[model samples]
Target: MGLLNRYAETLSELGSFVLPAPLKDMRVGLFNTTLANELALPEHLLQPQTMLDWLHSPVTPLTQQAFAQKYGGHQFGQWNPELGDGRGLLLAEVIDSNAQPHDLHLKGAGPTPYSRHADGRAVLRSTLREYIGAEALHYLGIPSSRSLCLFTSEDTVYRERPETGAMMIRTAPSHIRFGHFEYYFYASQKDKLQRLLDFTIEHHFAECKAATNPYAALLGAVVTRTARLVALWQTHGFVHGVMNTDNMSIHGITFDYGPFAFLDNYEPGAVFNHSDHQGRYAFNQQPGIALWNLNALAHAFSGHCSVDEIKAALSTFEPTFISQYQHLMLSRMGIETNEKEQSLAVMQSWLQILETNNLDYTYCFRQLALADINKAQCPFHDIFVSQENRFKQVTLVDQEKTDAWWESYRKLRLAREEETELLSLNPAVIPRTHLLQQAIELAEKGDFSLSESLLEATSTPYDARWDTHPFSKPPSSSTHTSLSCSS
Candidate 1:
């Protein structure tokens, strides 16, 4: 409950107070009833007129004076001090039934002092993309911000072209980022920077306060959570197209979804954000980039932590990430072994098979689990042999080589009981880019059937029923896989 309210007045210099701009013909396009119930939101607030009125003018204790946060970021490895909540506002903080506090953020609310020269509005397409992406990652057992509701308007917004303006209510443990501390630190406002750090620790990372050096403990906690988070992303083949420091959540959840995608084929070098021409945020580069961002954050904590302690905290990233990633990868393969070197070899060889054969990453893993449980229905070759025609650019995997790898894999495979664990670890569905575009196109035409259906599929990704659904397959032909950050 102390999110922004506890410091908005004291930290007025950190942000600006701005009410949401009224949108014409606002309609609730999608809502997360499950989340609403969990938050115990009153039924009246769920109504369109009442909610819209509250967004523009707050009267209930549920909300406070809305304000946009001020922060700066290192974008594409270059420090940019002008970035912040350009079109979003921290409307309020709500404590759910479980007493866990969550920030209620409204994206596309309106323009603010940080909007620069652009209109502070989000298109329906991008709004839905963020909405679907957050939920998809959350349901995949990954840490992520969750969507509360989406409201579309008749007001037109222009990006690459004209589109309907929309707003999404996003919920997260906290909206604080590494950039928040960076902004004050670089501005030479050490007092404000310390205040921000203490506030963040008090509300979010309270467990660190009991340590002899709370600041160093906070850094270590962030590093550990971030390592595990990015490791999960790699095991699931997720590509976070933009890894700017401003987009890095202090809570270590996948935050600021923009130009993000799941790997259709296991291409380690894949880049999904069109603006990333240099492939700085490529799929394979996420772990390195994460460490880089942590190093940038370490600069902000210099006043509170000694260089050696900060380095000690940062040094945990690599081993933590490797341990988490190795465990997840081996679990997906149903390989139960104490030999780390042998398991790493098995994992690398399996990845080579997928890359060499151009197999669908999701399908290959799901099929592997199925073959172990039901070999008659899901043969092992369904991934290697049957998918050869789909990929013409590369030759099929060498049969002799695959046979050798298969023999090595068989020796490490777990017992039959591990099949269920494998199936749960490997999802049968992800929010594929092609399918997301289709949902966006249809939603633009006021047909939300596809979007609704896609949300359901993503929210229950472990269900095998989706394997045969049209949404499960990758794009038949390469459509526009990259995206602009306009939204």
Candidate 2:
């Protein structure tokens, strides 16, 4: 706990008090001791009792200062002015050996002012999802909040049904969201807005302070980073399921992973969140939705800059996203971006082939790492047929069309020859929803073998051994991949 005071932590100056409601019978079912060690936390602090005491006791030095930061957001493309941290609180910011401060957030601790008539608890099922979900994204070369610890309790909380309660501590560079600025901006609280802006630039966006237009430069920086982050999501087939501005981190990381899913098949328009009946956050719509969120962020800075100036900054989103996406696609194929249009054409054709055949998205790109332009391509074609049987999908591909596609692919590869980089870029395993479900299911039943194994497997997703890890396989028809906001 000494680490908390070591950092140059700037706790919120806002005077809103949102007290934590303690659990009745708090107990830890699982603890991530490995991550704790990585953080250089004292070995004695690894015990469940220490964590439960720190979280459940309101008078602890750390907990006493914890408060729910207020913010507003656009939910599913509609502005909601009354939103904040409903089920969590910022306990403190702990600095590492590198002198970098990271937020130590207590999620699912209890109800706050922002609970808005909800239970303000997370079940063991959903906690597991966040635990592995964050870890998976981290290992995938994506910017994400990493989970530090998780604890389960005796209390049962009701969602669709009564489920055991759990808490998870997530560590991130910062927890600031676009809504944080929007909270003051929309309320016409100009002084508070300036305070928050100054605090943000002084602590997190220090580099922006030297710019001629720090606010505009800060907004532009967020635009570029956010565009690139969403591009990475598209490359890997991730659907965020919810793109509410409140969930969009100003730091450009994949902030909140709720109702999220990887491509089960090659369905670009797939909406994993059943609550998303409108498919607003579908696989293909992520880029556009991210731009929409950035637009909301720019509006938060409206009084500071002209509408035309903001729009000009926003204009960079599309080009930044397009270039990043193209570069990622080319790098994954071991092709250089010598001719952007041609490289994209080949990538598009590859996707078309996979989508047309309903092939496994992760594996299709993965095996391409080992692709050979010289081989007759029989083994490659056989993989798809084998995958069809494994996933219980009927074989369906036009042979003539497939043959033509193969020839085109061969020509593309023969022209631009490269190898090792492709293997590193393509992941052999992902935290498949099916695997997460099984892990959570077994964990809820007092078995953590699967969850622990999955943690290890996903930690090194691009390793060769994962090719046979069983988790590397695609989701079958019976796999429960669909999720909701509750998930």
Candidate 3:
């Protein structure tokens, strides 16, 4: 009972302690050996049989009491007070080799007090997606939660259809979310709210405590990190389908991967979550939605900071996001000029080219990075030749403008390590929706080989070896643009 179990012992008033409802015939489907070694997890916890027994057994010295966090959030722009960890539990906090603490959360563990009328179970299809999605984003250099292991069982769970029950152990700095503050704020629990703020700062943001106003400083830091995170997502064409306050982590990492997608054709208004009929969380709307979520969180700090101070903190969002996005977009194109306006013009023109040609987002960037400026006709040109033939959207005027943009780009100063920088900035492969569906289908048929291969491919997203791999290419024809939120 070291500091690993301190959260359960100290934060008892914030949540209710509960035991996990065991799954039948549970077995480890996938394990992150690298993450385990990085965290220096106990060797006994690495063994499947021992891990399963520990999960099912009564509380022990090592296995502390698990708890369901109580939180409230705004869903689809409507405030909902009755929301919490319906199907998840925070088993315990684990300290890494560097002494950094991370919450070991069990998603789909069992029903808790917040499981309002629904089964507290997760299916393999969704859990696998999350496991892959988290690793993919992490390798892509985005801040996100990471999966430790995936456990599947003979237990059946029903969603839109009968599916195999599964559980995934995801780790993050802390499980605290915007909703945690919101819940206490709205409930008028001032004492609990202050306790939470102090606890969070002490555990995660110790530097803030030295500031004149720690609460305001903490909010400002969160604003900057969230802005940067969303900028990275936009630059890489990733869309987090659900961005409710509860899903927004206070640590500013990507959380709750559900119905998320990467763009195939560069459409600004792409919305992949089937429930988003209004396109509220569409690709182009991500930045705006993020700011909206931040505003909701700001209300919780009203008692700690003045309205003007909170506004000042929130105001950093736009400039930070714009600067970060422009820098990333410029890097992705291999341009290193300090002239912000010109570089931004080039960035916009490049996006226009991709959008007009209806080209695959990842392919265009990878090909451009690999293109030779000395060659009159490089492989990058071939991508356009095929696209220009398929779509009549490219007029003579548009072609001229595109050619002019290319001429300017060719004349611009390149980065010191242009090709390497571009290659690293622009991933050769992403976890595309069609590819994920293929992996899921194979896994459902009792074959985890495809899933394992995908995890491996995604773990090294920038590897040149994947240049010609099937996973690098978007599906020839895709019917999975949008997905249900069942899982």
Candidate 4:
């Protein structure tokens, strides 16, 4: 059979592969069958009903020609000479039911020539988080990697602790990172860099094939998509925690859900990753970081594209992000698009209040969708402490200053074509930090019920029914001060 035909059959079943000897000591775990169903893969492909069955199966993976891709990227602002699918391998590329080609990767399956010094085993905890978090992000309509399968084993691996071993089948449009190009350039491998660029354009940037300078066009496209993606993250109050070059995808999908969090309250400067002590990837700094990463990527392509052209393309990040964010925020406010300054002023003032007061970001906007805007009668107000103090503070502000802002906001509302329109733009519930922690805590005890419930709630975050769920609350003082970069 042709390679594509053989791949088609494997997609229908968990066809075996010969495990490279280097990976023999690594433990295995299988994902739930539900993952196969999500991918619309054939039923037989989902072997081993539980993760345990798949993990211990003596069956080996198919031995196919390795699809080792080459690319470059920036690491913490410095150029790296070498980085590829160091530990993981791309098993195959299959077209899903949606006709989208997805790369199936076996993370921690074994070490390759790229494995530096660490074992290629993944921890169960991190695997579980990626499994569910990827699914959650997909359902939330964010461009992200999809979790096709997850497996766990009794074997112990030590990171911070001796944890059970696990592996995950990660799916994405393309695993190509900005660092891929950086790797070649830093090695002075211009010919190899050109080959990588050709392959990328052929596989992912076909739309730009006709452009005079396809490499520059490819950079531009990545910049545009990434800007919009980060804007979506900002609007939803999500912090990716780690914005490393290798973690940034060329197609703009959010990947590497390590130390990630949904903000409990609207703190623009919120930092979720404990490792990010300097706050380089804080909530508000995400956009800036994104631009920085893109610039690094552009620098890699400097050989093929002029520095002036790259700078002009990079310039699009700010305006594109601001415009996209403003539009999304306006939709959440249920205000029709109006070119007037008043409409924009209302959004500014409301966000300022949210940030200044440390209000529950998701609830405040959700409550605004209701009939009552008054704090005392607002069910949403309960999410905040008694608003008396806040209200008094608002009153104490120079009446003139407050009145000017309020009048501008009111005028913006007056221009709103209708009040009911904004409801769809704002979501009533987000995967709040406290609730996710609770779910993780329960999952750690071998109870997945809360995790399942939280998943269901987050899947329909905009639904009013979510208001009854306790998972929507902000973390108390006792919650972990920072999230760890674990599964």
Candidate 5:
């Protein structure tokens, strides 16, 4: 018997229900089951014995014993009191080998009391994006939800169009959101709010339980983690695209990979989601937006902590984010530096050059990792569209400014001891917006080979040999901005 089955024997068996043939093709595996086996989860969970015998043999209705959670959020900065897990169901929780608890959620299983007049089915395209995106982030060393299984059914789901339906089994340290606290606090449910706070502390922030002001400690931890997470995202050129209050995770993991993109060109104002009219969640604005969301979360804890304490905690975000981002950027640049100002100046200069020249962000940094200062020729300059103009501008700048910086950078690189090591920190390939669009387009036509290959290449993004793949390049002008959120 599987570990899950053995574990399940201890808890009251929740009745099981057939996923319905409509959702079969996309079936993946349970998160804990996959990690427990130390084996890659099968693309689909179709084993009869595992489903029938191990997963509670008989078909049963989903238990409705737990009350659905209610949460309010400032959607695009306007308060909306009616928001919850409208289409999501929390199946159960399981303890992992580390003894940490994880929530197992079945997204698109069915509608709950919170379902607001919409079917709960997820489309295959979105399911695939979430599955691969989450897995990529996890492997990249970013804290994120893990994708256990993806189940596709024959059932058709209607959004803007009729699409094949699917469901995803996602595992997270906690599903509790910033908005969850907002719900109780805004409704003036002090008793319930305190109950939720107590539960959160005991479950997710046990270290803070002994603190005189546990809420303050909790807020500080969240702020610190969130700052680090945003730094990771920025360093990798990832744009979350939609950073609403509800989408922010209390545990600081990156969740909800909706309309996201990796930057091709380093544009500070880059916008990935077509639905975002005001550019509220642009690439450069993410750090500020994260702070805003954290403030919202801090507001929820206002009953237990003073305004000054919360502000102090929130203030840690900028410094923490900058420190983490600088460390990551130095590693990417192959610079070993304890000097913050000098290293930050080099990083900023490179970003400024890339932004000025409209150079591909990933390629520019990857090339700079191999720049040769002695030759009086910077191969890194070749990535720019008009190298002559850029080089001329570089020459006109104070030579001392450039020379001193490069000399310091060279010494820093020598200290690091390996050029390849630094290059490895910056990936040669990313899931570029154009390529993702192509994969989505092909998948919609029932062809998945391109998508599969792209997934394979992105999983091992640092591999230089894979650069020969045509999809690795920025898209032509015709298809660059044509992508839609629906895909």
Candidate 6:
């Protein structure tokens, strides 16, 4: 037997209103049996037919309820009062082994109250991105929403072009976004806002409920989680592309993988989402943007908490993020964070080396993992031999700066270097956008094997065998592809 349905039982009490909507031609094209087993879905519900039916059936009997959640957000730093589930629906939540609720959300489930003058559908290109990207984050030991299964059909949607429809079952503890609280607060619905807050506290923030000031504790918990999450993203060179208040999860997971990218060449200012013209959500700006979003979320608590209380809670975000980021970066050099050698300055020097040389982020780190600790020379420079720098547009590297950083790293390594832990932290492979574009192109021409293969490869990304995989290599050209909102 798999998990039992409990979402419908507590759906109303949790403050999410149902907006029942039907989808067309929802046929299961691909099923992720691996994730199904991991999520521990009921044996009967694990089949593709059962998952397909439960997701699309209009008058559903087994765990069937279409709900479009309400949320308000600051899009590009402007208050967007009306933004909610447009192409997605929270179908149901299931009880796992420990009885924790995991939302069985259907992205690309079609139009609801939130679909404003647009077709509520997602294309296969983006579906595969989320499907593989979620699993990749998990393999990298980052906290994120998991993908259960993928479904595709003949349903067509208008994006940059006419595209085939696809949907993915995203698994998360709760689908309640930060914007959910903002939605009710902005609408002057104090009763609904309080109900939402109470429900959140009961289910997700139970620890906070026991605190002296439950509401303040809840905000503090979110701030800490978010800070750590962004720090992980920063060290891993992950650009989330979009950092809207609505896109930020209240539970602090790396959800909503749209136009996300890992570093191709070590450009701190790398912009992955083409739509983000201002570089507000660029690779380097993630830390600042996270704090900005947390500040925006703090405003929602104004009616419930005092100004002093809010300031105190929000104040911890920066130090927490910076400290965590330093520890992570220091660990990358095989230096134990608890030692005196673990300095943020050492990490910055390494970043400056990469920035000056314009090296491949993943490849350079991987080669450094194989470096001889006794050597003072730049060990990963060979990987960039005869290779052009994509960001700096040069074939020559700054040897002087690279040598200086190498000497510093060697000095730190002499004291306390744990190669095993460093290898564990830095991955040998990431779902490169160049390879992803190739896989998506192949899928467009009636071949899904590549996407399937990529998913499998990413599930164990640090495995040594992937070193020979074509995806392990960085792009050879400066013309790297950039994805947009549609992607």
| Predicted model with the maximum lDDT | 3
* Model 6 misplaced regions, further than 4 Å: 1-26, 61-63, 337-342, 389-395, 417-420
* TM-scores vs. true structure, each candidate: 0.95, 0.94, 0.95, 0.84, 0.83, 0.93
Tell me the number of clashing residue pairs for each predicted model: 0, 0, 0, 25, 17, 1
TM-score of 6: 0.93
The sequence of per-residue lDDT tens digits that candidate 2 reaches over residues 237-280 is: 88888989999998889887788888967888888888888989
Instruction: Report the lDDT tens digits of candidate 6 across residue range 221-262.
Output: 999999999999988988889989888898889988999988
Report the error of model 6 at residue 293, Å.
0.8
lDDT of 5: 0.67
Each prediction's RMSD to truth: 2.3, 2.4, 2.2, 5.2, 5.3, 2.5
Q: How would the candidate models be sorted by lDDT, starting from the highest?
A: 3, 1, 2, 6, 5, 4
Which candidate leads in TM-score?
Answer: 3
Off by over 4 Å in 4: 1-43, 46-72, 371-383, 386-411, 478-480
lDDT per residue (tens digit) for residues 365-471 in model 1: 88777665322232455456656756655665687777677777766764334433677888888999888989999888888898999899999998989879988
For residue 48, model 2's alpha carbon misses the true position, in angstroms, by 5.4
Which scores better on lDDT, 5 or 6? 6
Better of 1 and 6 by lDDT: 1
Lowest lDDT 10-mer window, candidate 5?
1-10
What is residue 70's positional error in candidate 1, in angstroms? 0.5
Decide which is better by lDDT, 4 or 6: 6
The order of the candidates by TM-score, greatest first, is 3, 1, 2, 6, 4, 5
lDDT of 4 by residue, 186-283 (tens): 77878767867777788778988999888889999999999999999998888888898888999999987788877765788888888887899899
For each candidate, the alpha-carbon lDDT, in order, equals 0.84, 0.79, 0.85, 0.66, 0.67, 0.77
For residue 85, what is the lDDT in candidate 2? 82
